[model samples]
Target chain A: MISIDWYLALSAILFCIGIVGVLIRKNAIVIFMCVELMLNAVNLSLVSFSSHYGNVDGQILVFFSLAIAAAEAVVGLAIIIAIFRNNFSVDITQINLLRW
Target chain B: MITYSFIFLAVLAVATALGLVISKNTVNSALFLVLNMVSLSGVYLLLQAQFLAIIQILVYAGAIMVLFLFVIMLLNIDEEESLFNKFRIKYFVAFLLGVGIFAQLIYSIGSFSDTLPVVSAQMAEAGTVEAIGDVLYTKYSLPFHIIAMLLTAAVNGALLVAQHKTKPLTEEND
Candidate 1:
């Protein structure tokens, strides 16, 4: 039997990589991608725990998370487009108009 | 066999995630992210979350990635720009902090290695499409409806916000 611990460890590593990516990446879109990665990591752990407990709640939660993530992608990408339209750049460092 | 599959998929996922983060071109990053999502869907299948696995591919790999690609092309981002913007001390400190957190997590999880209960077959089978559908429409029906409304609102709002601005051409008269 493949232990749940392996899945949990994988989830944790992926989450950390996402965190590091968020910290170091400069592009707004790449940052958004990192956020998605983090969300995926969470979903992995949720499914792992669901399987561990032998219940449907975790998978149900994953379903909801996936839906919400899609919605977020729509809104977030739209916002990114709007920003790009005005600024002519998607670099996070350069788009600091609100950095008072 | 399952263990090997898990390792392969996990490695694929992490590698693509790294590629997504480091690739200079926004389009390349988006492509790498798609790979990551597909690998994750495979992981979902291994976990016996069959419905979620399909949804992961359909919604995330299919829908969301296309959306990202559209945005990437629409923006027409220049690829000549440097991938890393700033290499300041603050970012280094943040990296160190992240590593610390990762170490702590591994240690904490490692300590409880033997305590996790083996999953029951009944619970494992509960991840089926039928099982999820029954529960979703019953116990989670209200939340599901609310989410549907929320998605509708989000679509409308995105359309409204992304609509092209039409400013009057003041210089045309000159």
Candidate 2:
């Protein structure tokens, strides 16, 4: 009963929340979670479009994206941990060694 | 029928997202993210992409998040306090960017009604796993390989980043 439009709207709102998380949170771990949220939002839209058209390719693509997300989370979390250890804090503001 | 459930899931998803943003406890945030992912899996099911829904649950809700929990627990994150400030401008700019993207998507969807029917007719198959495998193997082989390579890259990159160097730079013992 949920129209494709409704699905799209839900995804849009979720995507916006993810964007806000990425923007407002300074913790790298939180930021990474937001990135995952964004990916999930896109996945929702992809499945909706695939179903709307009856195409399976879009659904398949979600698998690939999920794999990439896993890799990203693993890599990102590691870097954050390493950064935390090096700096003794995950406060993001204190770990500004790379910034110009 | 499903619209009611859709609204329900939407509420759950938003609530968890708020938790993810505001929760001071890292483990709590991770748990909220799991809740969010589970609701997203429900969204996929509603879309009729059964395969994708399962993957969303298994990979995202199950595996990746457990990994997050492990790190949070192993590191024992809570005893330390997180510092609070200096990025107000960054947050405002990112909010504006999100609004811009949403506006453009709404505009495009509104303006392009004519192409909808054709797109729908083409996608009418409600993509099955077999159908996807066939198309990806036949029509989109190169992109598939590229995606594969990217996954490999991300995995390798992550593993490399995670490695901790125990050896000291001074090497006095050696």
Candidate 3:
């Protein structure tokens, strides 16, 4: 039987990669993809724990997370598209009008 | 067999994730993210979340990714260059932080073992659609309805925000 620690480790590594990508990547969309990666990592952990405990709560929670993720994607992409229309670029470094 | 499958899926997930982050072209990155999502769904299957596995593929790989692709193509943004130029201090800091976080997590969780009671066979059935539906509709019905409302609002909000320039304000002023 695969251990829970294995899953946990994998999730942790994936989450850190997402964080790194968020920090290093310049494209707004790629940053957004990294955020999705972080969410997926959390979902993996949640499922692993749910299975470990033999409870349905974790899976149900996953359902809610997935729903929220989808909603977030729509709003986020709309914002990105809006920004692209005005700025003509999705590079975070370039779209710094709000930077103080 | 499960361990082997886990290793395979995990490697695929991590590889595609890295590719998504590093690929220069946005379209290529998007495709890599799709591969990552599919591999994650496979991992979900290994975890016995049959329903979730299917939903992951449908919602994430299908709907969400299509939305990403549409915006990506619609924007027609070009590839960014010199992403790894002169070693900025921030990049170093970010890498350090990532490594620190990973080390901390691994150190903390290394000794931990599963203590939860093994799921009873019947309770394990809860991973199925029918079982989840029973709980979702009964105990979590209010939140479910709320999520439905939220989705509708998101759709309307996206439409409003993304609508093309409706005859510039200057035309109205004239």
Query: Considering every candidate listed, which one attains the maximal DockQ?
Result: 1
Across all candidates, what is each one's fraction of true contacts kept? 0.74, 0.58, 0.67
Clashing pairs in 2: A53-B123, A53-B124, A54-B123, A54-B124, A54-B125, A54-B126, A54-B127, A55-B127, A56-B127
TM-score of 1: 0.92
CA lDDT of A10 in candidate 1? 84
DockQ of each: 0.72, 0.56, 0.67
Clashing pairs in 1: A54-B123
TM-score against truth, every candidate: 0.92, 0.84, 0.92
Which 10-residue window in model 2 chain A sums to the lowest lDDT?
A1-10
lDDT of 3 by residue, B1-174 (tens): 888999999999899889888888889889988998899899888777889999999999999999999888888864667553244886998899999999998888777775653333544587889989999999999999999999999998888787777634554553
Candidate 1 vs candidate 3: which has greater DockQ? 1
Candidate 3: where is the Cα deviation over 4 Å?
Answer: B84-87, B115-123, B166-174
Task: Give the range where candidate 1 chain A is weakest over 10 consecutive residues by summed lDDT.
Answer: A91-100
DockQ, prediction 3: 0.67
How much is B32 displaced in model 3, in angstroms?
1.2
Residue B100, candidate 2: how far off, in angstroms?
3.7
Model 2, B1-174: lDDT tens digits are: 577778899899989987887788888889999999999888777666667778789999999999888888867774336523467787678779888877776666555343343235444345445666677798888877887788788777766776776434685674
Better-scoring candidate (lDDT), 2 or 3: 3
Residue B34 error, candidate 2, Å: 0.9
B10-93 per-residue lDDT for model 1 (tens digits): 999989988988888788888988999899899888888899999999999899889988888888873737777576875787
